[model samples]
Target chain A: MRSRSCIDERAARKAQPALRKVGRGASGRGHGNAVPLPGPASGRRDQRRGMPPMMRWETRDEICELVLADEPCNEIGTHMLEALERFVAEARKLPARALVIRSEVRSGFSAGADLRELYAGILTRPREEHVPALRSFLDRIHAVMDALDTLPMTTIGAVHGVCFGGGFELALTCDLLVADRTARFGFPELRLGLIPGFGGIPRLRREVGNAVVRDLLLTGRTINAKKAATLGFVSQVVAPGEATDVARRMAAQAARFDRDAAVTAKAFLKPLPREELAREKEHFVRLFQNPCVTEALRRFVESKDVRPYLP
Target chain B: MSDTVTRLMALAARRFKADAAKLRAEADFFETLGIDSVQALELLSELELEFDVEIPDYELQGVKTFTALAERIDKRR
Candidate 1:
């Protein structure tokens, strides 16, 4: 029989190499210099400057940055979509046993579509170009989310502040979501006179009940972490500053298991049926036809200067 | 000496290792060898199936080493 002391010593030995890999000082390359700024601070500055934050990779299987940062409006553009796709692809290839995803923004995980990009696409591009551009962007976004979902590993979303629109969809694709007490989650696309174009509607409905998904999406209302947990949207809700730690712990635990089973299990549990997906597509078409959506689009157009729209 | 544990571990090690030299003892979890969280979870899932145990999220957060995890599995068994 293995004595407890012997087990503890073996565990420590097994864990030591991984721990050493964890706290390695940030490499001073690329945007790693930006590490000094907290996620919120960087987000705010990027918002002011009107540019997307440079996505940065840390040593211990973590990715941070505001994807759309300061871009034209709050809309995700082709460039940003490509960057995200690349990140997801690269992350899938990393040697880590699990992956943790977090945001740099303080009040909003992502404010949905970049309005400036949308406005530009609408105003400058021909009417015929609109659908193709939108579809292309959606496809790329779907690829990223799909990669996150099907990667042969454990994925955890460490959510704090606000997770809305596309950000909410991103979190939903993760295997687990660990949210901070201050975390706010929602799908306000309907209020904007649009549906969640990037797979948010079906994923949200599958995560929470249809009722909660209906209430949140149709009303464009926000739910706090506690409420989200009650509705089964959030896996765990920690103190405001504790999300990263909790995510790390979860990642650490995931690191100890077998990879094939994890991938197979995830593939098996995906809840979106073809019928539901078809219905969601119809909902998107109807939502774009609504006057509420038109007015919401107008509001989105007008709100360009408002720092970050906290959910 | 369950075939399940040995097979699961072998698969995990093969997926995680970049070179032949990296594979270590059964006690060496992938994380210690520079395996990321996603890879770790992939490994965990195999163990979950072999042991028929649902690893709770909280316990998942606490696992740091293979020996610690193996013991946890042993207890459940």
Candidate 2:
């Protein structure tokens, strides 16, 4: 079985220093450089100055709300991953008692991994550099997921529209998932001949039953919010366009609890499935090495089918 | 046309704001509704909620018409 030790030390080492920098370093590429968004109570105009285009956050009344606004369904790519890393680091330093992650994009919360970008990387980079590069990317994203998973405060994902693949994994990191009637959850990685690379399988299995996990992963079918709620993963299913409001209320309630008691309970109930997550990453890297993944990604990116997002 | 087809067409028109009279059973829903894949998923969700049936996305693969979609829902019902 491939393990963390099997990963290239050189590539892993290269990612460590960058991860350490956390928020804006001397290079001014961190949260410090992000545009200051108006807090929920501020009623101030949004200031988009210098904000990373992928994400932005505001804190008020000891609550932090981060908005994912990347265009075209908020596909997670290098830009989004970097933005998330910055958010994760900044979240640790905040005085917030609860965090709410929501999306402002019209289409959905997020469509998933940016297959076009992945395909582009594959075509532009040499085959020898592929696995190492992929592993590094996975490592960085996993770190963000781990950090979010273990944050001292309560976290809620206000989901709507498409939450598939990497996006589904990201939502799974939340302490609670609040999906609107319009929200849909899916794992379509199998269609591309790859597993969910962003620590999805382990987190999903932890939240829902093994049967539900197998159904979504193996069939590669998307499920609507009502169906997801019935399966017991989604904590609440609000009316359409009301997920964020419901999430904000949940955050408020969570913030009212004793911090230490809440943190302890969270730690005990939702310990990170570290071993499984590591194995999942290794499995993803192994599967990604196959040529079929590349070809499948190519077909996805190049396809003109109006229903390409469907099975 | 079957009642299922008629109701399906009506639902699509209401969800997508299309002209119910203009919606033909055989017409491609993608073209008739002027929607892409994402909107198609939204339509799928509406269908599930309306019909109270779970339609795996794969079941709708290559299905692009109102009558065909109704048949899928009918089988589930």
Candidate 3:
């Protein structure tokens, strides 16, 4: 079998040029999306040799930027999960004052969970082990999300294109979301016969009302960045390819404030919905046990239709 | 064709760099323009921006031609 990193590298190379073009007309600086580089601050090729395939982070001007650039779209599979875990670990040790999570993939921020990988796992493993495996993955992801959510520094999600399911959930982990006009946000898990297992529900409820949450979850319909802004979930709606730039500025502003005071204000303003999050994981695990989920994922993974992403 | 369909066809043609005169209101856009999923999404974004309306992706399910898409946009308007 081929290694995961190799596949991601191939896709990264294939997508690099088009990804670069997304920033061309934005600011004339042409740095619309920051490509992931190896090492903390030094741009050295040697340090890149063993870097993770899914993402990479670097700190500059006291702001740590994590760029998600894997594949056709950054699907949250084992590779992404592990990469995120590594990010949290590195982030905690960094002296950075702010964090910005963005994507360099031209297709979007992310399409969501790696449905193909999930389906393959179901096929290879025993049925009895499925729930346990899912539970383990959820537990690990939730831990990472919780850490990011409660991090003292202000975190911003600079999102564009498709931010659905787990991807949207990942964005919600940030303190604020800055979306490009082309961005579309949704929770399409209902189409897969499951709920978003990555704490999307509770996190979203923290940002918006229940009616908005219900519409997204029940309809599985995507909303444009403009609609998302009106719904009060996205903090800023920017021109195409400018989300990262806007987020970086926001991070800069955040850095100017007293770090301890900012941290305290964030803690006071945004409390984690611990109970709802725990209940959500249980509901997700229970829903994942249905055989229909496997079939739904299989169809999604194997689909050749142009609108497969459309729920 | 209705005016909505005509305008929708023209918008799609311009965005995709196709000949506006050669495009038809009733043509299957995905087939006519040779677009994949990402381009289809770009078109969706362009339409939402063009029409100033939110036509949910589910509403466009099975909608292939500019005429059908125009109807959905019209309804939302």
Candidate 4:
């Protein structure tokens, strides 16, 4: 096993593992003359303090935990989405046997996209502008999700309470899901009149079957971890706060096998079809462009009310 | 305050689209900007690119105010 010693917070704070390309030292060519001002969270020059990173990578014993700091609850904003993709790429570039995705957020794995941003940006824009903006946004997001899906390494989603909408959609991309018993899993997107744009529907269909997906997607109700386990939504349903540790253990075991053989086996189990995935994106875009859907999203934002879909 | 600190604060105010004079050095980022985790990360990313310094997410996890942000950036520099 590849073992790693604990990274001292004081010392670790000084290193920028993700940005080594920029070059590190007492003085760099850019961002001239930064004075040492250690705050609650250590930061490189050119940043404000007292805020948490949306996501971080911690590598040890050949396993990397991409943690979503609690302060943020791992919400995926446009920038957060891009950062996640970048971080994944960097981790893949590094030598790691397995990847475990989890969150340290007290509330849950992630709260999904920023509703404030979504409502503010989408509502203010004119109706004609909605389709183009949404199309580009969906296209970019689909790329990020595709990045996670395409990783050669095994990935696990360690889920806890309140994984809804985009967060739930994200967890579906993982090869294995180890959910906490108290976890709540659901797609609340119907409330916003938008269907899953990041391949959630297809993944759910494959994992839980069409009937189950229909029930969950149509009703917009979340299931507890136990129910999800029985329904095959999760492989392991452990006690509260044990999701991340269990996932790590599982990743270690997976990493123990011959890397090539494991990868080949994974490829065999789910050979993702590019054509189908592309179709999924198109479907989301078309539906979002529909007048009814746009009107619903706008109404939801303006009134903060949920009007049940009649169709 | 150092020039670096003043500039960093100003940059943050602009990114958050808030009034520079109104932003307190000690205010929590989420509270002051009314932005979520992802937006905050975007601000960090913007700063990194703008100043050409690397601010790892782990290092900025506890930062919530202008003062802490300046301190964190200073340490990295």
Candidate 5:
């Protein structure tokens, strides 16, 4: 079988000159001078003149940074998702044997879907307009997850602080996860009267177990990193500031293996069958009939404590 | 090295920069090559498929280098 690593390496090498040209241009412009021009202009410049500002590659380590540097309130906006997709695609082309992906946020990894956008879409727009917009947003999120899943290289998710909803789902797609002891993880979509539309339920079920997945989806409660590690959701729990280092170490070790075999094995261990997915969808449709789900939603909306059953 | 091992090692070195040429028969997998836990798990997953052997998570942290990994594979063989 052809080695995926070789294919990636070749592609990266072929693209190196273009990448370097962009790097030179960005450096020449001076970071401070690169104001947030109009979105279209900045985006065009990013595509034509160099790499996107949010993504950076460390060739020797086979690591990439997907930073969520926009203000915390801007979480899960259209621009962020676009940047994530672009970075993930570019990272897949890098020659590295394995890849380590870490969030660049200090306080929280990500705040899940942008609530402002959601509220505005539902309240101000017609259902026809709102549903398609929501679906498009979900599709973009799925694209990011799919890219992470399909990358031939082994991928590590190094998380800290808070990783909620879509951010949590993104981490679930990784082959391995490393988190700080105090990091928080959860699927808060239920509080908004919605499901985790970005592949969270299926992926979480595959990683942890069906029972835990049920509780999380039904209750939308957050869990600490230690608890996540204990439940086998997190692969490793490190000291507060050590998640990235641990992830890098893990990536470096994984890089030693035959990349083709790695890719094949990951593909082999994918989630349950299509029939099973359909059955799960049916159950989800009936979720409103369940007293537990309804009560949980009520309590979540009423500002009552619902933490006990969330994990 | 066997052809299979040689090719695999070359791929690893090229991608990981682990200096396969410097690997000794008894070297520790992670210690010698700076393999962290996540990378070790990924390597374990790859090895399991390549050799059709189940190298459990508990055993993954113990193996440190390609040479040691080869010995383990040899034993499994």
Candidate 6:
């Protein structure tokens, strides 16, 4: 079987020079999207290592940064998920004072799951044939989030571009959310006839209250960074290119504390609340088995038109 | 390490999924226990909460063994 890591590495190496170019994607001009490494961009060698080098992990002083600096849409996929798992494991051991997660993908933080993978495979296949795979995938993703949510150190999500579906849920896991003006957050799973499968609903409800959560999930609507801030979740909303820079500074400041105190404080603020993560998977798979879901997702994959889920 | 420490470490090793028998006073994490950094930190945090003593990260930086950890906690207590 081909390892997901190898598949991701291949994709990373295939990027054009423009994709790996450092400092500010085309959208941010020179001030945007800092690549983790400084060099001539040896993505080729990185690919040889059989892992996506785009999603980078870095530690400076006592601070660690996990960057979602991917090309095109930086869509979340199994490979990216695997990379995050490895990064979190390492970060836990490092006992870093803070972890900053940010996306520099110009198109969006992520376009949710890799629509191609979802559509071409599960959506197009017989529901019974693919349900097991989808269930396994969601379970692994939840495990990743579980590890992330329980990390003993502080976490900041520096969000930019489109944070949709699972990607949006991933950002919400952070202790603090710092979004760029260009950032837009939403859950588009309804369009594909599925719910946010990664414990997003419970977390969203906790952050934004019941009514707003209903509006977002039911309508599959998106809110810009300013509106998100108004909702009382975003810690800071900055100009187009400043989210990462601001978030890093926030992390640096957060890192000044004694580690144990920070962990205790976080635990006090957000106790391990009862959640229905397992149920989310059960519901998601049940929904995915519906003919409506399969047809909707198939149509999405084929045409990319997104009108079905809208209210 | 004191016998009390040996007992404490036995519990800590269980939490870390490590063998308590290999957890020697002088084994020091990297040299003897071979506990990964993450496991070591896990043990530290578990111990801190267990003892209700805050172990500073600086103190943990050079700590290498079960004995060292016990000594640090003793000083704090």
**Candidate 5 lDDT, tens digit per residue, A76-120?**
545556666666767767777666666664445654554433333
- Candidate with maximal TM-score: 2
lDDT tens per residue, model 1, B1-77 = 45444554566566565443444435446444565332343345445555665443235435555555666667666
Which docking class does model 1 fall in? incorrect
Candidate 3 per-residue lDDT, tens place, A6-116, comes to 123422222222111122111111101111111122223242244335676777777888889765667676556766777787677777889999999887888777665
**Better model by lDDT: candidate 2 vs candidate 6:** 2
Local accuracy of candidate 4 as per-residue lDDT tens digits, A1-311: 54432222222223221111211111111110001111112145323123445466767777877776633344454545556666755766656678898887765776565443344444456667656766676676777777776677788999986576678878887889998754666676665556666677777776887888877777665566666787997999887689999999999898898889877887787666567667777776666555665465444334411111111
Better of 3 and 5 by lDDT: 3
Assess candidate 2 and give its lDDT.
Answer: 0.76
The 10-residue segment of model 2 chain A with minimum total lDDT is A30-39
Better of 3 and 4 by TM-score: 3
Tens digits of lDDT, candidate 2, A122-220: 776677877777877888889998999999999999999889888888899999999988898898888878788788889989988999999988898
Q: Which stretches of candidate 5 lie over 4 Å from their true place?
A: A1-57, A271-311, B1-77
Model 4 Cα interface RMS deviation (Å):
19.3
Per-residue CA lDDT of candidate 1, range A158-203, in tens?
8875566776777788888898765666675654666676677678
- Residue A199 shift from truth in candidate 1, angstroms: 0.8
Ranking by lDDT: 2, 3, 6, 4, 5, 1
A192: Cα error in model 3, Å: 1.3
Which parts of model 4 have CA positions greater than 4 angstroms off? A1-50, A70-72, A126-128, A291-311, B1-77
lDDT of 4: 0.61
Kindly list the per-residue Cα lDDT of model 3 for residues B14-48, writing each as its tens digit.
Answer: 88899989887778988898776666777898789
Name every residue pair that clashes in candidate 3: none
